[model samples]
Target: MLFEKTYGIDLGSSSVKVYSMIRNKSYIEKNMIAAKGRKIIAVGNEAYEMFEKAPSNISVSSPMAFGMIANLELQEIVLYSMMRKIDKILGIGSVMYFAVPLDMTAIEKRAYYQVANGHWLRKNRVYMVEAPIADAIAMGVDLENNEGSMVVNIGAQSTNFSIITGGRIIISKKIPIGGRQMNEAVCSEVRKRYNLQIGTRTGKRLKLVMGRLADQHKQARKVVGIDSVSGLPREEVISAYVVNAGIMNCVNEIGAQMKVFLERIPPQIAYHIAKEGIFLTGGSTRIPHIDTYLASYTGYSFNLSDLYETSSVTGLEKIIHDRELRKWAQPITQRKL
Candidate 1:
């Protein structure tokens, strides 16, 4: 079914991303939902609190893995509940325009289609679009102008790089390294250095507050984690040098991939990216000097978006209003995905 109103979803690893736009206006937004044993016990701000604060009875886990729906039943239940809650909260419904990774196959795309379309109330008709294309649009890369631009979106599961020209997505792919990997690397380092075991929360804090690229950000952050020996909590301060060393390995991986993609890009479009430079999005973009690190290796300038978190949704909001975008996108019914 065609929808005059649209709801855009990101369905990220750490969050259930959704936004609604009526004929007049829309907001860029999301909810952090926590899951355990296939049940969604909490959602939104409550779920976010479970990150470092939940009791042992709660095990907060990411529902979306590697940019795909890892648990369909949990995901559907989560979506169904959210839809019902949103309906009550907003008193409006619309079709869903969702973003999936560029690397997902036709089959995976079909699965999203199936779940989104199958629901009874707000059984959504999904319009599938790669994240970066929306990123380009959000970055205001004019497709008709064809001024080339690239976007590097670093998130929990994977880092994605996509090249866009004239408002069309040209090449896009995913690298395995991401925020979770950085968190794990920090945990490994803390274990080796201080004999402390940290949870995902502590590791993520290190990534944000203290994590740096190798030879960048010389300061360190004091970290707290579980005491490996005493089975109690422990605290220790570590230099950015150590944290940097751990996460820099992942940063280097992205740089290497960027160089490879740059080499493959035709000189013509490559010029545009080199001129307009690369755009950075996703929550991971906030890590200190990530752009600087990328620049050091690639020697290509990088641009930062003001609305990094909301840009993708804002871009899709624009797309939803475009007849051309609707025509190019295949309407994915919930049954097909």
Candidate 2:
């Protein structure tokens, strides 16, 4: 019998996370790719470095957008490249578990299978675990007895709000607003106020360094950008208030939508959610006092998860190692008729 390894994967728009059962370790890297026409130049962090800096001849971009695979070929390339780094032989006979979005179409779901079974990973077996289910497990929610659990995952390019009960997802929603939009918002605000043109990456840095909701701090960071007037590079001091203003625009919209979602759900679930605060996890949740801000907006407390971006992958890690939790991961490929 051939030896087989187990792996858990979460392919996020910002990054790709993988857990190796044998090594008992998880690896994360930017989910980016740089290519010159059809030829690949770099993948992962190296490619991310080239983003917005690469010459016009070279294209640097994420293969994923809005938590979905936009470029299957590039996505496969990224997966294979990352896996090869973990296992030199690429774990040819590995059993792979993927944390996937619940709102995906059949074609989008099939893309996961294609990526796992394509290229150098053809010998691998693939399974699907709903991203929210993985998130709940990672948040220490007891899936089997879950009366009602709310999870709002604010990812890089999108936000997913979901409800899970009795080990199943009852409601799931994916909104296009996320960290990316916040970054763009920052750029817009900067251009409007500072008369400086900055890239989304720079906007992202400003957002992370200064974004705040409650107890607003007066902080400033020096950033270099093209002056909108002269069209020349210049350094400017960007204040926290400006950055937070941009971030809050997106957060307010998300909170408003959350309120509507809560209103439509059953009262019983709302009761349980009220008793046990909403579970919040995602990369975007790292913004300072975002939980407090959300609570203020929705009038419901939130249980902030430190796991952040790794929540879903961490849940997949547990599901991969725990036999009892294995039931939550379903086989994606059906047997041929």
Q: lDDT (CA) for every model shown?
A: 0.72, 0.92
User: Distance (Å) between predicted and true CA of 52, model 2?
Assistant: 0.6
TM-score of 1: 0.85
lDDT of 1 by residue, 140-167 (tens): 7666777677888887768888887765
User: What are the TM-scores, per candidate, against the unseen true structure?
Assistant: 0.85, 0.98
Give me the displacement of residue 163 in model 2, in angstroms: 0.9
Query: What's the count of clashing pairs in each model shown?
Result: 11, 0
Q: By summed lDDT, which 10 consecutive residues of candidate 1 come out lowest?
A: 22-31
True-structure RMSD for candidate 2: 1.3
* lDDT agreement of model 2 with the native: 0.92
